[model samples]
Target: MLVGNRVILVTGAARGIGQATAVFLAASGAQVIIHGRSEESMDETVRLIQSAEGLEPLRVAYDVRDEAGMKLAFKQIKKIFGRLDGLVNNAGIMTEGLMGMVKTTHIQEMLDVNVTSVILHMQLSSRLMLKNKQGSIVNVSSIIGTRGSEGSAAYAASKAAVIGATLSASKEWAGKGVRVNAVAPGFIETDLTAHYMENKKEKLLETIKMNRFGHVEEVASVISFLLSDMSSYITGQVIGVDGGMVI
Candidate 1:
């Protein structure tokens, strides 16, 4: 119940960590907004939140890469909720292509979704948050952002850019009652990472000191902390929930 009466918006809420965070926040008493590119999936997430006795989250289906869509979505949010207390930039993708096979389009898409969307979301959200003189933003980064991963150069680069932006924005809004931070999750058991686990489950576990993949709930709790008053004194930092993998 860390976010009682708060308003939260999460990207990529159709499934995986985004869905988990949205549900968790709603259960904590926040009026959550579930956003994704798929209307059906967003609806499913809404159902789950309702099933858990959590508040029914508003579902918004829009591509994060669409600039106009982004503006309209945020504007619509303002029309509905009037103010946003927390924002989680969690929409992202990973393409598996070797360096030689990677194309320019793949790189651009990653940059657009992972890096550019985050920058613009923060820019607009900050303006609204600044008016209320209180807000929290959490960017969902990855361990690859810290340690470059093979076959994921573009993804790693985009996430690294997220970490950089989180640090910079945190500093910029320090005294404005806004806190910007990032959570770098490693080897999470989610739909996005299912393929890798299917093939290299044992190998991956060996790399993690905890000998297991991180859970979506674990990452969601960290998000809740950052969004709650518990983390009021913390900002501009990237917390790793990697099970000692990145250490």
Candidate 2:
């Protein structure tokens, strides 16, 4: 395994892509720390990873936007793992609204969770990674961010900011051994998107080249690669895991 013995922390891992990434990384032999807002939800993620890989992930519960709590998380991570090797900034929220009708608070909420939190997580995690001189950060963006969606202005803007942050962060750490990248996933089948997918099935399928909602594991595969040595020379890249949805 390319990441054996490495310590990787994945935020927003209670379910969906975050959960899948945590499980996949554990299966790939990396020691994973699952972060989310609830201990119960994180426990379920740990249980799933244990069932699939026979290895349980360490759990860290905190709102990614909570700076003080996150500082404590990093301390705890260092206390337990000694070093941070990888960080997956997968925590975000999706809000839907026409740009003209979107409420101010709704847009702010989207930006806070999807963009601000990612920057804070990357900043704090990279500080720890700098000591080790090598690390990788993978942010989760969306196809809407790249192609613009009609009723998803806030969500698109937030995700677009993720791409911007990823680019600047990569340049900041370019020759310092810390790599930053992002995965812009298309319509993925998960509890959070299940309702929307079901409601817009016919319309959604028409836009996807693959004609199917992506599985969490499929997106997880790309995230796992970015966090591993297999992508050693890759940085400042946004790999779309949307089955060519944007194409």
Each prediction's TM-score against the native?
0.97, 0.96
lDDT for predicted candidate 1 compared with the true structure: 0.91
Clashing pairs in 1: none
Per-residue CA lDDT of model 2 for 20-82, tens digit only, reads 989888888889999989789788888888887735688888887788888999999999878
Model 2 CA deviation exceeding 4 Å by range? 197-199
Query: Candidate 1 on 1-247: residue-level lDDT in tens?
Result: 5689898899999999999999889888899988999678687788889987888787788899998988988898999999999999999998868888989999999999999999999998997899999999999999999887888888899999999999999999999999999999999999888887455778778789988899999999999999999998999989999999943
Cα distance off (Å), candidate 2, residue 13: 0.7
Query: What C-alpha lDDT, on a 0 to 100 scale, does residue 221 get in candidate 2?
Result: 91
